[model samples]
Target chain A: MIIIISFFSFILEYLFNYLLKKTLFLPLITLTTTVIVRPFFKKNNNLFYMFCFILGFLYDLIYTGNFFLSAGIYLIIGIIINLISTNMPNNIFTSIFKIICAVIIYRTLCFLFFYINGITIFSISNLFKSIYSSLLLNIIYGTLIYLILYLLSKKFNIKRID
Target chain B: MHKKEKNKRTIIILSSIILSIIIATIFIKKNFNIPSYGIKDGMMYVNNIITRIFGNKDYYKLEKENEKLKEELEQYKDYKSLNEELNNEILKLKETLSIEELISDREYAFGTVINRNFDYWQEKLIINIGKNKEIENNMAVISNGNLIGITDDVSINSSSVILLSNHKFPLNISVKIKIDDNYIYGILNNYNETTGTYEIIGVVDNIDIPQGSKVYTSGLSSTFPSGILIGNVEDVTTDNFDLSKVINVKSETNFDDISYVTVVKKGNK
Candidate 1:
């Protein structure tokens, strides 16, 4: 189930990256975090981190061309999300809040990495634009994935850590 | 439970070590990213077909635009004979002076642009042709009959082009500005985003170069062929240090609407 979600997100990322204009960024990180760090994969921390690392490694290999950069970023973000989501309430509103927080952390980490590496020029305006432009679609995507998993978890015997 | 805890700790330590080693290697060695050449090319090919089938464009507007371009092309046709005569005269002069001939005669590989990742949209573009098409690094790419960029990285089935408008990368192409049969050479290195102009610096000539003069590749550099049109001078000014002239050039080629490009393959540059 986790692999299916990861693969779906990967395909969507490729399609959206090619088809969509520069303004609309499909949040692959946000979508992956919302599902993999949820109750379905809670007890399997090692597997969760492995999935994040591999997904990020593939992303770097194909898209970014900076090996291990996104892998490390995704691993750290996954760990942070897991630690936080364990304490938060497992409901619709809290899910939305978690998505928002995840996006903020993700963007902040990316900005810091890019800035430190001198990959991008120092521009606060550009950073803010990247963050805001991705918010609307990512929030919707995160929430929808959460709702689907919530329904599936009820039907099956997936342990809910929260 | 004790065994599970130990296993988890082992996994954490191993992961940390592996990640650190890979990161260190990447930092030490440039161009370390593993190339997924086949997979990327296949995905791009699929993307091209999908976009073609579901491309959203106003056809009526495009038809009208095409008609307008056809009329403009007719005007250029009138100057074709005069242009040919001048080119012939230039060739004769070069032969008489024992000068090296420009690479006006070359093979061109046509390719469709397949991807422009938003993160590097301004910096680079991925094209369908690569090593398979004999494309090499530093080859010049043109679209809309104007020099747009140069090929940077070539994979098995695709290539990445570094656009001139990218500020993230340092792009310095030697160019010549024609002023009444005299050419002023300079280095084009800066692109002004707000003004939509290119800045050509390092021109040490102490002469008056009028605005609207045409810019072309000097061919002094090995990367680009001579006589490829760059743009027209929009403004001319002296540098702050008052050592050399800086010319601002405006290009007619629209960077935002590029879909097809041709890579010029020169022989033994």
Candidate 2:
């Protein structure tokens, strides 16, 4: 199940990246989908972390060519989500909120990385535009994924591991 | 007690992985030639198949249009060769009277865009042709008879083009505007993100360039061939110190719909 979900997430990510290559807004569909479905396998923490690392590493290798950059970013996100999940109630709203937070944090780190690498010149308006558009698309995609997973779990009688 | 131990172990593992990733990133950054192990090639192959299967049909339509345009271009090439022969005859006549020959040769190769960088602000494109096709760094890429960008990185089967609109690696091209018998010179520098236009600087304050004046490459630099159509002057304003005027140019190439481009190379005839 974990492997299937990870592969599906990768396909979704690749499709989105190809479709929206030139757009300012990038949807973190794979990360969001993984986060939304994570509650289903809450007992398999090690498997989940490994899955995140592999997904991120493959993403960097195939798309960005930045080596382990996305791997590190995905691991950081996985850690944060895991930490938060321990305290937060498992619900659709919480899933959406967590995904939003993750997206924001990841984008901030990316911005800082690009700034340090001198790839993007610092412009306040451009930064704000990037943040807003990225947040908007990610939130929409995250919400949809959460709703779909919630419906699937209810329909299939899947029990939460916790 | 068992849960606490598991959590501690997880933290240790996560930290080690992160540390290793950071070290690997640094190492890869220093070693520039590390092969991608066929990952990039495989991904491109799959992507090409997917695009062919489920992608937009407009690309096919555009390919047909391009074929028609190529035919027209062949007709123009014949006319150009005849005109060049006449000019060479005139130059030969003048050479007998002690004038120097000034004609140079240029070669062009066509390529299709295979990929583009996902960074919105960075205008970089990857084309299908590469080092095997004699493509090299600094070759100018043109689309729709206008300058698009120059080649930056070239691999065995692909090359990355840095576009003119890129802010990080903005290109400087010498440009000119002909007014009656006089030619006005200026340097096109950085792309302004706010205004979405290329900033033209260093024009003499005396030359009053009218709005909608055509701008072309002055060919002062070896990076790009001379007289390639760049864009038209949209607006001109004086700088803060009043020494030179700041001109904004609207680029001729429509970046959104670029499908095919010709890489221009300068060589001996």
Best by DockQ: 1
Q: Provide the overall lDDT of each model, using Cα atoms, as 2-decimal numbers.
A: 0.73, 0.72
Candidate 1 - chain A - TM: 0.86
User: Measured against the native two-chain assembly using Cα atoms, what DockQ does each of the candidate structures obtain, in the order listed?
Assistant: 0.36, 0.31
Per-candidate RMSD, Å: 3.8, 4.7
lDDT for each residue of candidate 1 in B1-269, tens digit (9 for 90 to 100) = 98999787768846864674467346524544335665676676666666786555557877998999999899888889888999789879888998775566457899877777544446678888888889998898999888888997688778889888888544578899999989989999777766879899999999898988999988777677788888999999999999999999998887867878999865433
Q: What is residue B179's positional error in candidate 1, in angstroms?
A: 2.0
TM-score of each: 0.84, 0.77
**DockQ category of candidate 1:** acceptable
Candidate 2 scores an fnat of: 0.24
For model 2 the local lDDT of residue B255 reads 75
Listed per model, the TM-scores of chain A against the true chain A are: 0.86, 0.85
Top candidate, metric TM-score = 1
Question: Could you say which candidate leads in lDDT?
Answer: 1
